[model samples]
Target: MRDDIVTIEPDEGLRTWGWVSYLLHLVVAVAAVLPGAQVSIALLVVALVIDLVKKGDAANTWQASHFSWRIRSVVWAGVLYLLTSWLWLLFIIPGWIAWGLISIWFLYRIVKGMMRMNAGLSVETA
Candidate 1:
């Protein structure tokens, strides 16, 4: 009988950047969900840019999935927000509910990604 052990090494630098991006995303997401606690959209933009720029560096690595995950999360949330913008123009209560739900979803994604990254696991893109 033979016994073997396998070890996986993670890129610390990429993980550091991932942590920074996730923290930024978390702040924006939390602010979005809070009433009258709006934060600058620039923080999200900065996080997105960091993901976009560092995505290539993560290619072929487990960390790549995290970058993709964050990027897709932002894109989907932005699209959903834009699509539901009409609710705000037509009615107030519905708009509040819709946006609130979207913000929560965004927050969930960021937190999930952060957890996975911390665990040194790849995020599920699909």
Candidate 2:
């Protein structure tokens, strides 16, 4: 039996930034779900740029992972959107299917990442 325990020291700055990142993701999700995809996508891009800029300054693995997760989500969603948009003219149904899948993926990443953040666990990229 292993009796070792792990403890994470709290950092107010990282926690605050983490919450800000998560809230931005939430805004993107809600806006994307409604009729504000354009605005949400622009916001998402801005959020991603901030994540990239600040990731190097993160104090711990947990904080870095959150930024990485957010960046991955934004890039994946953007690529998927662009691909679907380009192909929509040829196959409308497939485009819709791709969009739906992307939305689910986006939501899943944000929810899971936030939950892990709250639990003091690092986000798993894999």
Worst-scoring 10-residue span by lDDT in model 2: 1-10
lDDT of 1 at 108: 94
Q: Write the per-residue lDDT of candidate 2 for residues 28-88, one digit (tens) a residue.
A: 8866665445454566666777788778766455567788889888888888898789668
Off by over 4 Å in 2: 1-10, 34-39
Candidate 2 colliding pairs: none
Model 1 residue 122 lDDT?
Answer: 78
Give the top-scoring candidate (TM-score): 1
lDDT for position 123 in model 2: 79
Q: Across residues 38-121, which tens digit of lDDT does each residue of candidate 1 receive?
A: 899999999999999999888777787889999999999999999999999999899999999999999999999988887777
TM agreement with the true structure for every prediction:
0.90, 0.78
Q: What lDDT score belongs to each candidate, Candidate 1 first?
A: 0.88, 0.75
